[model samples]
Target: MLEIHQFPCLSDNYGYLLHDPDSGETACIDTPDAAAYLHAAQEREWQITQIWNTHWHPDHAGGNEAIKAATGCTVLAPEIDAERIPAVDRIVKHGETVWLGEWDAAVIGVGGHTNGHVAYHLPDAEMAFVGDALFALGCGRMFEGTAPQFWTSLTRLKALPPATMLYCAHEYTASNARFALHADPDNAELQTYAEEIRHRRDAGQPTVPSKLLRELKTNPFLRADNPELQARWGHPGDAVATFAALRAAKDTF
Candidate 1:
């Protein structure tokens, strides 16, 4: 079985360790703090075979070099961002699968959070390591990509099985839900979801590994075609436009 554990790094950043106990192989995702994860892995006595990256964000890839130097593991990243990420040994593209023993993940180029951002989806595990792309109840801020591009990418991701568990890079569920509520306060579903999220957060638990089905039901960003959101945006509005306004509100919120 593939056991996935999360390490909370640099306040809200989450670095993941995917371990296949049968194969005894481990893959580390987005090393924001190399020393921290390196130490933890060493203590666990697991072999760190590969380091995977979703984008070139410093917080996401900053610890790549340090961990590589210490562990001598192969680094896998997007081919487009090779210039920014010098440690990339295996430059992968969309449609390629990075095998982890019995489990293999298909890399989908999900740009919009960044120019070269690509999220990895493990179909067998039903997991998505979305770096700064889709959050719990909201999407990542449009930094390097346009709203249309983001919407398209998100649409592709949404096409996946609803049971697919999203493993995003940050722990912004509570805050994201707050913005979600502002976009459609009249949405009782959103209100209830936010309340549950707050309760989980208050108990010091992660409001994550959220299923795509749950997100589709309560998330305003995912619910672009929702009647309530359309009513709030005053009709005939694109979801991207609605999202842009929601993001703006969040910026000041």
Candidate 2:
């Protein structure tokens, strides 16, 4: 089985550690700090064989060189932004797959947060490492990809298996939940989940890897077609447009 671990690095940023227990090999996803990555590798006694970069943002790719230097690990990232990332051992394009020990993951291009942002999907495992594309209840602030691209990216994610575990790169769920409740106050699912999240956070725990089905039901970003949100926000022409308005409201929220 593939064991997934979360290493919260550099404030809210998260660097994921995926280990194939049988192989004793680990893959680091978006190492924000080299020292922390090295510490994890040493502590786990797992060989750091590969590093996956989801985007070119420093918070996401800053430690590429440092981690590679320390562990001799391969840095694999989107082909389009390969030049921007130092020590990119492999430039993976859409449809390309990478092997983390014996397991495999498909590379999916998600260019809303950044021009070359990519997400990794392990379909059989029903898991995805989404870098700023889709958050727990919100989505990434548009930086490089346009509203259309961002919407498209999220739609793709929503189409995944409902039980798929979404591992986002930031810890923004609590704040996102606040906005979600405001947008859909009577959503019983949202209210219950929010309370649970509040308790988890109060107890000093991280809120992440939320199930996609839960997001589909409660996250406004995923509820573009919900008549209530559209009625409250003034309906837009399309699903993407409606989602954009909700996102804009969330920016101020």
Return the top candidate by lDDT.
Answer: 2
Cα lDDT tens digits, model 2, 22-84, are 877789888798888888878888788888898888888888888888888888989877888
lDDT of each: 0.83, 0.86
TM-score for all predictions? 0.94, 0.95
lDDT of 2 at 10: 93
Model 1 regions more than 4 Å off: 235-237
State each candidate's clash count.
Answer: 0, 0
The candidate maximizing TM-score is 2
Kindly provide the TM-score of model 2 when superposed on the true structure, using C-alpha atoms. Answer: 0.95
Model 1 Cα lDDT, one tens digit per residue, 1-253: 7888787899898878888988888888888999878877887888888888988888888888988898888899987766787488898887789977778999888888787788889998888888888889978887888877877788878888999999998899998888778777887877888999989999999887889998888777777766668668764457777666666667688
**RMSD from true fold, candidate 1:** 1.5
